[model samples]
Structures are given as structure tokens and as C-alpha cells.
Target: MASKVTPISGFQEWLPRERIAEQYVLDTIREVFELHGFASVSTRAVEPVERLSDQGEDADKEIYAVSRLAGGDDEARLGLHFDLTVPFARYVLENSGKLTFPFRRYQIQPAWRGERPQRGRYREFIQADVDIIDAAELPGHYEAELLLVIADVFGRLPVGAYQVHVNNRKICEGFYRAIGIEDVIGTLRIVDKLDKIGEDGVASLLLAAGCSQEQADRCLALARIRTSDTSFVQQVRALGVSHPVLEEGLTHLASVMETAAEHAPGVAVADLRIARGLDYYTGTVYETMLERDPGYGSVCSGGRYDALASDGKRTYPGVGISIGVSRLLGLLIGEEGLTASRETPAAVLVAVNDEETRSDSIRIAAALRSRGVPTLVAPKAAKFGKQIQFADRRGIPYVWFPGAGERGGDAVKDIRSGDQVDADAASWTPPAADLHATLVTPGSSD
Candidate 1:
């Protein structure tokens, strides 16, 4: 019996044109990551449930446990990884003996989470992550360098006017300590909800969590400090708070902002309020926002984790960021109508002139394919108009007609403009722009 077909909530599926656009985005990201010297790595989908839940985040509720219906009692329990970082950490530990230190790698894979889905959020989504990890200690300069890597990737993409908001956990920790507040993580957890519940709501929660009215106000003040330059340091100092840890955090953040100014101008901002919510981030944290639609939440986010990857004998400290590919595409392709110029990769369709000469069309297609032109032969020997319509419906730009010229040579027609010209199968080439599908934004003229 045929079952009813229905779209599953939180699961994303794209049509052919949209899938082409997604492939273009993924290809651009992979190319840029490799160009920046990051090696690619892919880990398995499931890990020990204990490892997935060990991270000090509220991720346990979102974990999808994997099990077999006929499994024995001795079988180990496993769960799908909610994020790439955890599994990558496990991979590093398992292979530490063979891999070199100061390793830089990029992982692009899908992660499953059972959280409630909303705009730009999904149960199963693709994440592109880049990280640099080293034994014992990692340099602070990598925190700044990763920002430039993200900027470079977005520079080539059509995502317009985005900013990478940089913050340090030490700044929040030290500031909370200086103000006579205990339970720093608890306070951060509450403040992270500021976007959801307004300032009054956060203040109320802070007070209920045993914070004095004055302490709550000061926390709010700290969260409001945001700057595009090093001036954020001075502004933070003016708050009448001082601690050694606070000073250390300010210095580190200042260096990151200064380096970003020189390398990735107007791309990084020092936002003091961005407490990444994850307890593993011991230092610099990042959250990216598209200027066009900040309400869509962060399209990319990550931070430095000092103890995330570790065994008893060794610890790998690292910093990284993940691009929420599905989230970004949900807005660009699904909402704004961004798409590819064609549904298929084929740039030219070899039309079948007649049943007796179908082999000629196949040979022409083979010749074009050998020359790196995406070509396909028509399925049957249909009328000239019908064959042209087949190519048109698929957005194929050119159609090749065998033996259609006056001198018994092949002819190619620009289907869009209806301009036919005599051409040679051996040497003719499609224009560079038309050789493959190109991304088309909402307002741009193709």
C-alpha cells in the first residue's frame, strides 16, 4: 500500500534549483577552507551517549538516542551528535598518537537535534566547522585568525554586510566576580535569554537568583557594552569594576579587535554581552549576525574550548566556528527567492534530429562532455520545437542541432535569445559564466 506523503516538520528538503544553489554555497566554503590550509575530516554519526552529554551545555534534552530493537543487554547506548565539536574532540583523542600537534581541520556534516524548530532552526541541519587545536596550549592569535577565515568565506558569498561579534568568557566571569556576584555560569545562562525575555525579565530573573538590585543593574550595564574597535576596553574600565581576570580578558579582547581591524576591517565587533552559554568556552567567543536580518539569530557561532578534547594524559585546547548552512539557506533560498540559474548542471542539450540519427546526438554529447561542457542528449527523436521546449523547461541555455547547417555541419542555438550559429563539436565552448549553474540573488539581474 502507498503511504501518504507529508512534509516532516524540522526536516529540510530542497527542490532541484534550490539544491544547486546549496551546492554552490557548500563548494565555495570548502574551496575557501582548503585555500586557508585547513584539512577536511569527517567523523561517524553516533558516539557514546556519555560523550555527547558530557559537555556542560543543555544539549542532553536535544540528543536523539540510537538503539537497535533486537539489541542484546550488553550493547552500548549511543546517540546522534548534536554538534560537530564534540565528535571532533573524540576523534582527536582517539587518533592523537598518529596526528601532529597544532592541527587545523574543517568538518562539514549534518547534525541532529530534537529541539523545537523555528525559522532558521531545524532538527537535522548541516554545519561547516573549522578549528585549530594543539596540545597543552594554543595561542590567542588563532582567535583573531579564525575571524579572518570566516570573513574571507563570507566575502565570496552573497551574504551582505555581516558582523562577527567577539567576546571573552573571562570578561564576563571577572566582571561578575568584581561586582560581588557568585554563580557566574548561572548568571550567564540567564543573561543569554535577554533576547528572548526583555531587560525587565532578565533583571527579575537575576534578582530571583539571589542577586541584589544593584548587582543586577550592573550586569545589565556590562551586557550593553558593544564597540567596533578597541574603545570597548576603556568603556568597560569606566564601569568602576576591577579584577585581575577582568584585566586579562580586556587585554586579550583588545588584541583580537586590533588585529581584526588591520586584517578584517569592519568585520569584527567587541560585544561584551555574548556569553556563548556553553561552559567549555574558557576564552574568546564569537557570534555572527547578518545586518539585513539580525532577528534570524546567529548564522554562525563558536568559541575557544580549553578542555573539550582531552584524555587523562593529554588535553587539546582549540578555537573554532561553525557556519549554519541550512539556516542561512532557509532565509536566502526559501524566503528571499534566491536560486540558481538552472535546475540541472547541463549547459547544452544535444537534440535528437530523428530516430535513425540518435547516435549522432549521443556522439556530439560525448564530444562536448570530453571538452568539459555539461551536455545531455534528448531522450527521443521529437519535433524541433518539442526538443527545444524540453531544454527550455530545464533551463538549459544552449541546444545543439546535428547536421542542421547549410554545409552539413552542426548548429547550436542560444535558446534564450533564439540565435543559432554554425559550430564545431570539437572546438566550440560555452561561455565561462554559462558552463555551470550560477547563483541568482533576489534583486540582481542575471
Candidate 2:
């Protein structure tokens, strides 16, 4: 007897209809990325353990180490990459000589992490990432420009009423130092938990991490600043903090909000509390939330990395954003009942009258397929009623009869409407909408 098979936790597996929905989301993202002139790139799945060791204090625990069952001691240690950014940074350093300055690229691939699974978080998940890197200083304008690309992508997708919350790390770092907090990274790690622990919980953690009562109160005050326009700059200044880095951060984020207001109004928010847990983000960071469900966590997030990668001679500065494709679909398809119109791609099923006449059905299917229709030949020479029932069972809208027309020609019946009309296999076409399977969201019109 075979050992019983069970699902490995955190590994997402979708059925055929759900898979089609996932592909639709991916295709929309790829189209928007290319529309913005970002080239595509793919990096290896496994990297040397030494290279993956420095992501952050808590990253190592989430890494899934890879090893051969019968390997010898001389073999190199390797691990599956937890995210695309590290592998991408290594790729840039390895190919610096061949790549052009201000290189723009997009990557859609699976990333592995050995973490406990939650509603939207998974150990094996797909991420769609777009990044812009330069050999030297990357322009500040690109920071704001990435928001437009993200807005365009979400606009084309079915994800409704989303906002991309933007923040600058310099603002937090500068303000922390000006208030006598020495461990900026530790403080950031704590403040980043504001959403999970609440303001009081975060303040307790901050105090435990060596913050005075006034300092902890000031930190929470900074995190509470949220706005939709450039007014956030004045809000930070009103808190009575003074540091060159804080001033610079306010200027940079103000510029970003100003650009967003003009090009993609009401889509970007200046939320100072968005401290992405990753240590690599050096400047601006983002966290996207759905208006209907802010507690679902960020469905898309990334940020600027002035020192993403560096060789002994040069450094690559860049900024990027990644859409959590798996997470978004979990809410849309798994919970919200988003799905495709049909289980299969076939739009028209060619019915076989009998075994001898099956050749005629095959010919009709071939002709229809040659003309761009998704046609399928009946598997068996069943009765006409049975064949029509087969098509209906699979959600195939039309059933083609090889020679049931008024003359000795082909005819197709819309199974839903019971309307049969003469159609020439050589030239007949289904309606544009029926040519391909379409996404169907609950409560949305067909």
C-alpha cells in the first residue's frame, strides 16, 4: 500500500480554475511592467549560505537550507532564497560589466522561506518584482516614479480600493537620533510592530529597548503621522525634531507625495509607520493595504536600497516594489470566490454524430481552431443530447454540430440560450468575450 499523501503546510496549490485566475493576475502585472520599459530577468533559486547569511537578525531562522542526502563534507553549503532581492543583488554584481547604467528589470518567480504559514503568508509563494538600479547614485525621481507603475498595475487588476503607503527611513532614523535614541535599527524593528502590537504595546517594547518615557512617546507620535499630500512634511516639523537627515527625509518624501498627487491622485499615502522589517531598505519604503481589509497585511511592498549591492570598486543603488501574487489571490479567490468562467479553455465543443462521422467533427474542430477559436472535438460518438450535456457540464458555451444546418453545412448552438445558427467552420467566430475564459468575481456582472 502507498503511504498516505498529505499537503506540506505553507505550500500553496491551486486547482485548474483557480490557477487560471492566478495567471490572469500575473499577465496583467507583466503587461504593466513592460509598458513601463522594464526588461525581464531570472536568477538562480539556490545561493551559497554565506551570501544569504546577512539579510537581518531574524532572517536566518526563516531560511530553508539545502543539502544532498549523500553529499560529502567538501560540498558547499547552500540554501533556498527567501526573497528575490538578495539573488537579484548578487546577479547585478556578477553582471555589472554587461549591464547598462540605470538598468530596469522585472522578475516574477517563486521564493522559499521556512516560516510558519498564516492567512496570506506562505513558505512557498510567488512574487512579481520590478527594480531600477544604477552603478552610482540613482535619481530621486525614480523613487516617486515607481508609485505610478504600481498604481497602473493595480488599476488593471481586480483588486479594489487599494492604497500604497509611502515612508522614508531617514525620517525615522534622523528623528530617533535627534531624540537621543542610539540603536536606530533596533528602534525601527520595534516601531515596525506598531500595527501588530498597537501603540501602547510598541511603546512598552520601546521602553524595554532602553527608551525613556518621553522618547517612546515621541517615537509613537512620529509613527502616527499620516497624510494624503505634501502636508506631511509640515507635520513632521511640527513635532519639534531637528536633524539634517530628518530634513532630507522630509524633502524627499514631500517630493514623492507631490509627484503622486499630480500623476496618480489619491492613490499614495504618506504613512510614517511603514517601516518594512527588512534591513536592506535604506530610504523610501512602501506597504500597500486594501481599503476594505487593512488588517490583511501588505499585499505589495518594497523600497529604495542605496547600497543594495557593492563590489570592492563600485556600488549599485536601486529601488523596487514586489506584488505578493499568492497573498492577493488568497483573499480574492480562496475567500472572496473569484474564479474563471470555465474550467477548460475550450469555447466550443464539436459533437461527434457517430464513430464513422467523427472524422467530420475533427475536421470542423481543426478549421475552427485554425481560425483562433478554442475548439474541442468530442471524445466519444455519443448521442447529440449527451454531447450537448457534456459541453454544458464543463461550462462550454457553444456546441457545434458538423452537418445540422439548413443546408449540408455546420451549425453551432449556444447551450445557454438554445439558439442554433448556421455557421461556416472556415470563417465563423465566437463573440470576442467568449473567445477566452474571463474572471468572475462574486457580485460582479458577466
Candidate 3:
């Protein structure tokens, strides 16, 4: 009997060409992260279940537990991390003595969750994250810097017209308390569902949660406040709610929006409703969405955490953002037909004239490879026409002939254009554009 092979629902696997395209995106992300002076760090995939579960509201349900099939009862409980941030918090604690203050690091890794799969939501996904952590206290300017960092990243990618919706937790907490609502987190969780359930639904839920009709209406009013500039400060003030925390949140959010407007125009919006569900985020939360579809959940998000990582004596407060690499690629490459120019990276395939003279073709390929040109030798001593067909099938643009030039030296043919010219293996170079596989999207001018 033969065993059946099946793919799990949420684990994504791409074809060869698609994988090459994915690498291009990853390389670009890594280069930009380095340009900003963020050091790379990788964390273990699993953490103690207790630590993972403490992330906040509704987080424990998503954790995928890990246990050995034959392990004894003494094994410590573990679970695959739902996101990179949790493990990163633990990493800081274990290595705090050796790390410098205001540490900056970037991590790119896969995370797992047990949630039901849906569009742009996956059980297994890749996340590219950057965080800045400092001992005891962190500066507020880091929040503004993170928004610019995300803008820089998206500006380089093909993701067109996205906005980072910004909000401060203090604004919500202070405003809720001013209006006599006792449950700040509970109200935030419901308001966060505004996109899923419209204004009426949220109002009903708020009322059901024991908020007075006026309080529910007030909460809805605050969530609806959104602006592209620092003007949101006045908008909150117009609502006639006042608290020291609310005043502090207004000032903080105003500074962030002002910085974004001056440095990264049109990239950040002050959206008061963006109360991230995680309990760890202390202030300044963000959620990014494409301009074309406001409902397509956030592709990048994070926030300021004042006490996520702490030792008995010290605390590490930080602000960070994560790009949902898998979700972004799912929309770009899977549905939008983004791909690479070739299935293989080889730019030139050397042809063998005969079985006895195949050594000549191998030597030519070796010379090309030495010069950093991606080259491959013919698999068989097939006819020249058949060899050309093989190169074409694999999207290899050029085919090299060992000794087919007019002067009996050597030649290379651009199979796409049918242009054959004399060339030398030791000195020849492919055009810069042809040297490596290039990412492409359907209907793109490039």
C-alpha cells in the first residue's frame, strides 16, 4: 500500500519561480533593515506555554501547543510562538546583562497559530520585525521613528498606497474614564471590532457591556475621529472630555502625526479606533491597510510596550512594528500574479557539440561561473536546436556554443532575440539585467 501525501491547510508552499520572487522581497527587506542600523537577531521557535499565554486578551487560544510523542510527564510544556515579539521579550531578559542600553534588533522568522485560515490570515506565516528596547524608560520619538521606518519599507516594495493608522492607548483609556466607563480594555476590544461590525453593532455591544446609552454613543464618536494631520488633537478636544491622561495622549499623538507629516507625507493617519487587542501594548498602536481595500485587515502593526520584558530590578520598554510577509506576498504573488522572470537563476547554458567534446562546454561554464555569471552546462550532447529549446523552456536567455563562431572560436545566442555573436568565455559578461532573475508583476512596465 502506498502512503498518501496531503498539504496542511495553513502551511503555504510555493513553486520554484514563485520562491525566487519571494527571496527577492526578503532580500530587499533585509537590506533596508540594515540601512537603518538594526542588528539581526533570531529567537527559538517555541517558548514556555505560560509565557506565550500571557500576551493578552484572546492570545492563548491561538497558541499551538508542542509536546513530544514519546516524552515523559516531566517535560516542560511548550508551544510554537504566535508572533516574534513574545520570544523577543524573553530573549532580552535572558541576555540583559550582556546587552547594551537602547538595543535595536530586527528578526525575520515564521510563526504559528491555530486560528481558522482565511484570506490574509494564516496558521503559519512569516514576519519581519524591528524593535528598539531600552532599560527602565524609552523615548517617545522612537514611536515616530517606527512609523517612518515602515513607510520606508513599503515605499520600496510594490505595495501601493498604504497608510499606518496611529492611535494612543492613553487617549482611549483617559477618554473612557472621563466618560465614566470603568472597563477601558473591554471597551477598546469592542471598539477594535468597528470594522467587522458596523457602528450600530459596536454601540449595542458597548451598551450590553453596561455602558450607558450616552457612553456608548460617546465611545462611537471617539472611534470615528480620524485625520491625516495634527488636527486630530482639536477634534478630540471638541468632544468635551478631559483627563490628564487624555491630555498626555493628545500631545503624544500630535507629535507623532507632525513628524510623520513632515518626514513621510501622506503615510500616517491619526485613527483613534486602532486599539490593538494585545494587553502588552502600553501606548501608540498602529495598523496598516491598503488604500484600495480598507477592510483587508492590517498587513503591518505593532505598538509601544512599557513593561513587556522585565527582571526583578529592571524593565525593558520598547516600540516596534512587524510586516506580515506572508500575508503581503499572498496578495501580491498568489492573487496578483507577481513572479520572477525565470524559473532558474542561470543566465547562460553552455552547449556540448558532441559527447567526446563535452569537456570544452564544462570549461566554458566554469569560466563564466568564475566571473560571477550564472552558467550551466548542457545535460546531453543534443542537437544545437534541441539545446536552444531546453534553454528557452527554462527561461535561460542566452545559449553558448563552444566553437560555432565564424572564426571557429566561440559564440553566444540571445535565444529570445535570435541574435548570435562571437564571444570569449574568459572575458564575456551578461548584461546586468540578465545576470540574475528579476521579480515581475503582470502588466508592469518593468
Candidate 4:
């Protein structure tokens, strides 16, 4: 019988090349993060439950509290963080004095949530996060730039086509309040399900949340309009513009659109519709989708949260975006045929010439490594044919053979193209382009 087994669902472990493909997604995001001048920082994976309580943004429902099997009476609890943004906010508050203002940083780490997992959702998943924090107030340009960074990352990635849908919290909440809807978060929670549930479902949801028939109609009416540019203001203004909250919403939408056109143009648009699920976002909010596959849920999303973090003395305003790396990797590699390599980690393999010259094989592998090529020596002194096959199976591009008689120093075989030639380990190269991995981007799918 199999060892008494229990498998926790929604958790996954990666093998060699699968992990390489995973790293490709993460590493791409890191490069994009640094290119935009954001510094790098990582927070402890667990934080005191108090720091991540219901006081912040509303959705901490899936927090997993830690426990030790060996028990003690002094009780303490910590939750594995749900998202990078909250941990980052606490970090900024704790070290505010030592750090510079308007902190820009990127975090790449795993988070835990006990939610029922599905195709792209997980009990544990890594998020690539970048946020900008200011001591007092953050400018509108920061809002525009944040979306631009997100688009830049998505644009460069090897995933399918996508667009970032942006909205201002003030705009959405104000519009709701102006229309006399009291529970805006409740309304947003319903609206957030619109893409998943369709128009009628959201209408029913709003009605269930005690919104008036006219108010629900207006809300669904607003959610119906999706545009590539920011002209959403004029159309929404045409809908009905008597309320101050609606008026303010239009103005803020105009501001974001104007700035996006002037600076990070065309990356965002005012979807009078984009009522992101969270309540913490007080200003601009974002949701990105693959144009062809919007129902797969947002590939990246975030918003501006004003006054969410405070140093007991002053408030720290923040705005940023996060991309689901594993989520995208699953789609790209699994569905889109966007794979880095199916091979194990080695880049090159050296042939072993029996027991006598295993040392020679080691020397050749070392020489290849010194030339900036990752190399591995064959496990045993075996026949040249078997050694070559080993290199072939592992996706190692070049195989090296030590010269036996007068065949020269080393022989290099290009496993991919089946071209074999005499090559000196120190002087010869397998082409510069092949030496470095090519990053697959959205352009590749076309």
C-alpha cells in the first residue's frame, strides 16, 4: 500500500525546466522594474495579524495563520501575507525616518491565501510588485507612470495581447455617492464581479445589496461602456451629470486621460466602469486583461491608496501595480506554447574518455565555464556516442570530446544542427546569440 498519503490541493512544486520557464516570467518583470528606477526590497513573508487586520483594505479573508506543532502557552499568531502591497506599506511606516521620501521599490516573493484555488489561483503564489510611496501627497503623474510601468512589463512579456483598464476611486465612489448609493464598497464588490457574472448578474447583485432599481441601472449602464481611450468622460457626462460626485468623477477621469495622453499615452483609458474590488484605493485604480481572454481574470491590477499607511505622525500615500507571474506563465507555457527550454540546467556537456582522462573532461568543462558558458561533465567515462546522446536529451547545445590521437585539443558538436567540428575550448564559441537566452515577448505570438 502507498504510504498513508495526504495531498494538499492548490499547492504546486516545479521541476527543472518548468522552473526555468517560471523564472523567465519573474526575471522579465525584475528587469522592467529596475529599468524604471524602482529600488528592490523584500519584506518578511509573515507579519503580525494586527498589521494586516480588517482595518486596511477589506480583503484579508484568506489569511493563513502560522502554528507550531510543538505547543506553548504564550500564544502568538502571524498571517502569511496575502499581497506584497500591505507588507510593503508596513515596512515603509516602520522605517520611514531612515528611508527617503517617495520610496520606489520592487518585491518578488510568494504569498499565501487559503481561498479555494482554481486554474490560475493558488494557495501559494508569487507576485511581482512595484509601488511608489510618498511622505505627504502623491502627484497625478505618479498615477500615470505606474500604469505605464505595468503596460511596459506586459507589453514586453511573451503573453498575449492586453490593455490596462484604469479608474479613479474618487471617480467611482463619488459617482455612486452622487447617485445616492450609500454602500459604495458593497456596490464595487458587486461591480467587480461584473466581468465574471455578466450584466444581469451584477444588476441582481446590486439589487441584493439594497441599491435602488435606477441606481443599479445607472451602475450597470456605466459598467457597460469600455473604451480604449479616455473619452469615457464625455459619454458618461452625456448619461447624466447633475450630481457633484458624478461631476468630480468626470473631472478626475479627464485628468488621468490628459496625463496619460501627454506622458504615458494610450496605456490607459477611463472605464467609468472599472470599479476595482478593493476599498483601499482612494484615487486611480487599474485592471489589465488579455484582449482575447478577459474572462481569465485580470493579468495585472492595482490602484492608488491614500492614507493606508501611517507612521503614527503622518500618512504615507502609495500607488502601484502587481503582475501575476505564475498565472501568466501557466497561460504562456501551457496554452500559448511559449517555452524557454524543456532541458535541464546544463548549457554544455563534456565527453568523458574512460577512467584515464576523466580529469581531461573536467578541464574542458571548466574551460567552457570560464568562457561564460555553463558546462557540465558527463557522469562517467562512456562511449562518445552515448555521451553525445546524454547531451542531446538534456538540451545541452554543444558537446565536447577530448582529442584521442592527432584529432587536436577538443571536438565540439552543435547538437541542435548536427554540425560537428574541431574546436579549442579556450578560443572557440558556439555563436554569441546562442550563448544568451532569448526572452520571449508578446511579439513572439504574432
Per-residue lDDT of candidate 2, residues 255-312 (tens digit): 9999999999999999999999888898999999999999999999999998768987
Q: Which digits, one per residue and each the tens of the lDDT, describe model 4 over residues 323-405?
A: 87767666776566565553465667888878887898888888888988878899977788888888877667778778842
Task: Return the clash pairs for model 1, or none.
Answer: none
In model 4, the Cα lDDT at residue 431 comes to: 74
lDDT digits (tens) for residues 137-206 of candidate 3: 8999999999988898899988889999999999999999999998998899999889899999999999
TM-score of 3: 0.97
lDDT of 2 at 339: 88
- Candidates in order, TM-scores: namely 0.98, 0.97, 0.97, 0.92
In model 3, the worst 10-residue window by lDDT is 437-446
lDDT of 2: 0.92
What tens-digit string does per-residue lDDT give for candidate 1 at 280-305?
A: 78899999999999998899999999
Better of 3 and 4 by lDDT: 3
How does model 3 fare in lDDT? 0.92
**Ten consecutive residues with minimal summed lDDT in candidate 1?**
51-60
Per-residue error (Å), model 3, residue 196: 1.1
Report each candidate's C-alpha RMSD, comma-separated, in the order given. Answer: 1.2, 1.3, 1.4, 2.8
Clashes of each: 0, 0, 0, 2
Clashing pairs in 2: none
Candidate 3's C-alpha runs over 4 A off are none
